[model samples]
Target: MKKLAKACLLITAVLFAAPKVHAQISIGVTISANVAPPALPVYVQPACPTDGYLWVPGYWAYDNDSEDYYWVPGVWVAPPTPGYLWTPAYWGYAGGVYGFHAGYWGRHVGFYGGINYGYGYGGVGFGGGAWSGNTFRYNTAVVNVNTTVVHNTYVDKTVIVNNNVTVNNHNSFNGPGGVTAQPRPEEMAAMKEQHVPATSQQQSHERTASQDKSQFASVNHGKPNNAAMNKVGGSHFTPNGQKAPRNNNNNANNNAANNGHQNNDAAKQPNVQQDGHANNNAMKTTDAEKQDQQPAQQQQHVQQQQHNQQQQHVQQQQHNQQQQHSQQQHKQPQQQHKSAPKPHTEQKHEK
Candidate 1:
């Protein structure tokens, strides 16, 4: 009796640890970090249209380990069948951090944090059409019609987003202190229903190509195409949302090369200053030699003034360095010294 009780408790714990499944909907908690946000890149669609497909909007995702965000571009996807609707993906703030909830298929267009996926998927809900009987009529403004791919369904572009246009702006992409929206009853019901996970083709189409990886910020775990998720260290889901160490081998290499260049630049600074010093000294010596050891009164005064000015400039440079270096805990001291002006008594005596 005691063994059976222990066995039952273990099974119950395992079930609870598993991700929640409503109908076909399976949501998993992922461990990621507070990362620097990524810039939004322009996402353009191919001029031509493919039939029997729906559009999914692009978004920026945070990668915890890398401490960076990567943009996920929107693309055209075929509906599961003739009747299913696409639920746009959205992120919700929970426990003082944002949690990403991917879009899923449902009987109706569900709430997705009011993310406007472009076309007719504005913040409120899907403006796209629904299925009736054996036909599906999509809002042409939002969907491309290639009579070839979808024959039974026809769209009137005249009634759609005029000129097949989509709008994206701050007003639509809500930021801090912006509008807050929640899913409606119908949308919530769909979310509760068993979800059908995104298809393999859909998953494949969403990946970032290897060559294009550099274009995005490091940290996104999903391949967005080849693999459902990156199996690298710190890629798995954790409760605290702490991510593992980032794989910055490439970044480190680049940084090393950059450091080398900076050092080369520093090495040349003194050479440049020394060259200027040498040129000034040569000009003075040349003038003195040309005069055949006789000091021209006006020339002597001018040379003295120029020399003083150079000394003052060097002093100012040193002063600036001192001010900047004072805040640092460890910094190399400046080695170069400037020549000082001769005292008035010495100058008069020489005259």
Candidate 2:
């Protein structure tokens, strides 16, 4: 009993010591192989018109057994008690492994491991600031919903904050496999305060077995690392004789199509040159292959015809060169080759 209690204390201490360790869940490096995270359940908060309540965004959580990540969308949330603010859930990295911890209501907002939650949660700090008083003016661009959901205050559709959002579907080591950011001292202090886990509606009811499983199958295709998934993301040829560029870098995988265009431009010249060389070689090799398949008489005839054609082309080239040389010769001054010799010998002939 004492040993079990010691183990429990050690585990508790570990969790408290590194709050950022929770953000990471087990995920594979191959993007195509990455299972689509389950969609989080949506819940509505009872309206707190007193002026300090804030909305937390939903996000996808990773599941271990099924090997997939689940999506949990953000929601409208009430403060812990009164003066405390809500720190949005974010993924952070500690000692090379990423951990995911839920965001909660706190006395003051602290560092959130630079996680850019969609709809105005920039990587560093929450785009949504604290309540100045009983009035919190939401960024009109970021939050979206039926006007019915939010009634006590203003709703500006024009104010959007998730404009610079990226789909973070890389499944890479630093980015997705493990978490990479840690919380600051202030954030650690906030961890001990009272907070609420995702509410029932906030809980995504996504079932691994029941929900559509088609999306997970597509993530790992043609991905470089997973040899098994390579067949999925197969080599896609561009229109008009262009092939995708083969890059071994992670960034290239994310932006392969764009990089393919650049590579295609440079590849055009080489492809043309290669085609010319190939055609020349093909023409040469075809005669031999054809000869092997033909009757002896037919082969002789074909060889004779080819030889004649080659000779004719060579003669034509020579003729053209002669014409060019003649033209050049005419442009030069004329010379009297026999005049000087004639003068010496003509003394007898002229008389």
User: Best candidate, TM-score-wise?
Assistant: 1
Q: Give the TM-score of candidate 2.
A: 0.37
Provide TM-scores for the models: 0.47, 0.37
Which ranges of candidate 1 are over 4 A from the true structure?
Answer: 1-49, 132-135, 147-165, 171-179, 209-211, 218-351
User: How do the residues 41-98 of candidate 1 rate in per-residue lDDT, one tens digit apiece?
Assistant: 3333322144445656555554332334545545556677767777766554332234
Which portions of model 2 show Cα errors greater than 4 Å?
1-54, 75-84, 93-97, 132-136, 145-182, 204-351
Which whole-number lDDT from 0 to 100 does residue 7 have in model 1? Answer: 38
| Model 1 TM-score on a 0 to 1 scale | 0.47
Give candidate 2's error at residue 102 in angstroms: 2.8
Which ten residues in a row are the worst by lDDT in model 1?
Answer: 225-234
RMSD of each: 27.2, 21.1
Instruction: For each of the candidates, give the backbone clash count.
Output: 9, 48
lDDT of 2 by residue, 74-99 (tens): 33544445455656654433333334
